[model samples]
Target: MGLSRRQLRLLMVSGFSLFLMYIMYSSKGDNPSSLSDSRESANSIISANPNAKIDEAINNKISKLYQQEQAEKAAEEKAAVDAAAGIKVTEEIDAIEEDFDPVKELMQIRALAPMIVFSKSYCPYSKRLKKLLTEHYEITPSFFPVELDKHKHGKLLQEHLAKISGRATVPNVLIGTSNESKGGCDDFLNLHESGKLATMLNEWGNKKLSVKRLETPSNV
Candidate 1:
């Protein structure tokens, strides 16, 4: 067919517009042909290897077994670690028990003097009792003071003291060689006010153990 010049010019303009659109699409990375080629290649590979399906099943089974084996190994390792930790803890406890005897320790502390004051440094009542004993009275034998908070085995001592004395709180005042606790700070105050402390000290001692009251400032 013989085309007119105007028709040929219009056809060239349309062809140039189409080419521009294709260049824009290519720059934007749209590739349907590449996707189709990948699918064809995969199909060709599968067809060439007829036992591809069977091989895939065997690979999946092997992977699953490997995962289960790794999981079992991890579990066993965790159990072994926990057992070792438990054993170490048990051994440490046994060592402490072998080294420390609360009963024996308490007995030795009690035998320090005729009178012992098991106290905590921070307690208000313990402080008051200690002040009165140390500052006010002078006996033949000075009273022994044990600050429980300062002791390494303080908790064990306090527990054992509670069992023996039936009192858990501090400023635990005990008297005589038998470790007799008349009571804590409040009880001692009552005894001091009643003039019983002086008399008791004299009577309980091997010799005449006088609790000589010291002269101090009247304001104190």
Candidate 2:
């Protein structure tokens, strides 16, 4: 009871048409115009190359996936470029002459050559470190010292220093205009031990800084 070849062809075409109807029904909430165009294209493929409809469908899906991947890669590259651009944001700001801003004053002092030590007159840590810098190194431009206890806006400046540098204690050392702290007295000693202090001072002070003359004792 074998069916004729014409009858078999008719059955296959009818089954494929039912499958396409099921797909269209399932894509109900999607863009109607896009769906209509896809339906027309699928019909054209089926009409010209009856056996290739399944392959064409698979190829369309693969093409859509490739486009999505390319879009995601483009987004990631744009994010990377945006991050690089943000890295050059200026730390310095402009202000008026009459206005006495504590933060501005802090920036001005921190902007001094060689380095700046925001110290207290009575703090033994400050005394010891200052002595080391004066005796051991011939820093050309010389380091700037801000005696917070002697300043008019002492408490106010210290409060703001803590806010910016994240160091609340005496002997806060800033080696750059950006106010990047090099920690306190103990940290400075460690820098000397590691031989980075002399190297840094040479660049900032514009002179070859001398190495530690002797091992001074103070756990400040």
Candidate 3:
């Protein structure tokens, strides 16, 4: 028997609905299995490859090395900055030293007299030494008195004196042609008391006199 058109249409609709449900069910079932199969395949590959962990370890080591290299580069840059700053500071100090060269001033003073007395104007010890030398010994022209505090390069001179003489105090009495005498007030007083000061002055005076006599033209 032949079906009616409405009944045939209803049957076709039911069949189409069943087909859609089956498709949905098949998609849901296939997605999970496909995901599981992919996971299992990945696991099998990892198990077969013995060096998977070693590759991971090598990647981790490379990452660590990159980090260490970055850290070392930062340290080197910091050290370079510190070194540049140190050099600038050193240059500034050298410039100051050159500006106030005490040695040059000392040489100029030495040229004036072999016997030099480094002193300060207001110092009592300096006054005492000056009086002793000028009044008692009468060694005026050959005796050179440098008032350090009054001089332009006084501070630098003091620094140099401290280094050379091992004493930076006033009334630094330097005597003889060799300029060997390096002492303070006490040394001067001791020399005076011992009468060595008189003897030294006489000897120095005789040498000067002889030199003058030699310089004078002979009666030809």
Candidate 4:
């Protein structure tokens, strides 16, 4: 029998709802497969570029190694520099300790004699002066010879002598007193050649005696 209009309308509405539900279910099922296919395509693309991951890993490892090597090298250089600095400081300290006082020694030597010869044993000029003073002159008692190379305060004395006399060599002849007269080998030779050395020595000797007399008390 033919349905009434209301029943036909209700039947049509139910059919349409069922059709919509089936279509939504089908779409849901297709979405998962589509996503899986997309994932597979991405994987295939990555696989085609096989060296990409390897290159990245290699670069990272090499970079890390390079940084480590640089750090080690820097540390070694710093250690070397520190060691060298330490050695230099130690040497400087040793030099300071070994240095001598020149002024005090010079004063003491000057008091010892009026005619002082600052000489080195091995120097030719010093030998010449010594020979001339000892052999040619009779001034042994007043002649004072200082062998600079053998003396403990030699270097200091030499430096001080250089500052005072503007000469930094051996065979430095000092006459009368420490600061009174200064001459080198050439001056000594000149005096000897001119036959004035003996006269000069006699004069200085008499001068020393006069100085002593002046210093002595009148009653004594």
Residue pairs with backbone overlap in model 3: none
Candidate 4: worst-modelled 10 consecutive residues by lDDT:
211-220
Candidate 3 wrong stretches, greater than 4 Å: 1-97, 177-179, 201-220
Rank the candidate models, highest TM-score first.
Answer: 1, 4, 3, 2
lDDT of 4 at 154: 81
lDDT of 3 by residue, 78-165 (tens): 9999999999999987787788767777777777765788999999989987776655554545577899999866878877877776
Per-residue lDDT for 76-166 in model 1, tens only?
9999999999999999977886788888997788677777889999999999888877787887678888999999878888888888877
lDDT, candidates in the order shown: 0.73, 0.69, 0.67, 0.69
Q: Please give the RMSD of candidate 1 to the true structure.
A: 19.5
lDDT of 2 by residue, 1-220 (tens): 9987557645655576667655644544445468778887667656656436555665565566567668888999999998876664432212222255787787677566557888999999998888777766656556789999998778778888898888999898776444556678888778776768777655543443333334555333
Clashes in predicted model 2? 0
How many collisions per candidate?
Answer: 0, 0, 0, 0
For candidate 2, the TM-score is 0.46
Error of 4 at 90 (Å): 5.1
Off by over 4 Å in 4: 1-99, 178-181, 209-220
Which prediction has more favorable TM-score, 2 or 3? 3
Q: What is the C-alpha RMSD of each candidate to the true structure, in Å?
A: 19.5, 19.6, 24.3, 24.5
Among all windows of 10 consecutive residues in model 1, the one with the lowest summed lDDT is 23-32
